[model samples]
Target: MTDLERFKNILNEHREELEKEYSISNMGLFGSYVRDDQEKGSDLDILVEFSQPISLLRFVSLKRRLSQLLDVEVDLVMKKALKPRVGERILAEVVYI
Candidate 1:
């Protein structure tokens, strides 16, 4: 499968797990993975919107779990905490799942 396809599958898998364990309202694939410009070392960039505020421990745990599952680094951005520029860029290219 293509890298993008693999990335999506991993994302979906993690999304399911996160949804079951947390209160995720929305999630999307962003950055190079979504833009089709990822290199071999590119990490997965994800934007997540939670139904309620999540603790830092939960965020770190989620990132670690996804990184382990996908066999790559994960960069997760909380929708409520994103900077204006980063949010705009991610929103422009993100593919919500």
Candidate 2:
């Protein structure tokens, strides 16, 4: 399978646990991975919407856990934290998980 498919499967495999643990309302994959142009050592970009705001500690924990799960470095962004123009572009390309 392609790397994208592998990533998606990994995320989906842990989706329920991640959502409950992190209070996530929605989650998606974005950036280089979504565009299918990730190079060696590329970071995984993920966007998330939480059911409620999470503490910075919890956010960091989530990011770490994701990186461990996928065996790739993760760049996690919250939906509520995005800037307008950039948010639009990211949302347009995001593949919802």
Candidate 3:
């Protein structure tokens, strides 16, 4: 499978796990993987929107879990906490799942 397809599968798996364990409202894929510009070491950039505020510890733990599952680094962004420009950029590029 292509990298995007692989990443989408990984994202779907993670999304299921997250939904089972957390109160997330939305989830999406962005950045290099979504753009089809990822290099060998490009990390997965995921935007997660939670129904309520989540703790740093939880976020870190989630990132760790995703990284381990995908065998690549994960950059998790809280959708509600993004700056205006960054949010705009993410919105422009994100492929929701």
lDDT of 3 by residue, 1-97 (tens): 9777887787686776687676778888899988888898889898888877778888888889878877889998988789998789999999887
Model 2 lDDT tens row, 67-87: 999999999999989999999
> Backbone clash tally for model 1?
0
What range of 10 consecutive residues in model 2 has the weakest lDDT sum? 2-11
TM-score of each: 0.88, 0.97, 0.89
Candidate 1 lDDT at 9 equals: 81
Q: What is the lDDT of residue 51 in candidate 3?
A: 78
Backbone clash tally (model 2): 0
Using TM-score as the measure, which candidate wins?
A: 2
The alpha-carbon lDDT assigned to residue 70 of candidate 1 equals: 77
Off by over 4 Å in 1: none
* Candidates 1 and 2, the one with greater lDDT: 2
Candidates sorted on lDDT, descending: 2, 3, 1
Model 1 C-alpha lDDT per residue in residues 1-97, reported as the tens digit of each score: 9776887787676776688776788988889878788898888898888888788898899888778877889998888887898778878988887
Clashes of 3: 0
User: Clashes in model 1: which pairs?
Assistant: none
Candidate 2: misplaced stretches above 4 Å?
A: none
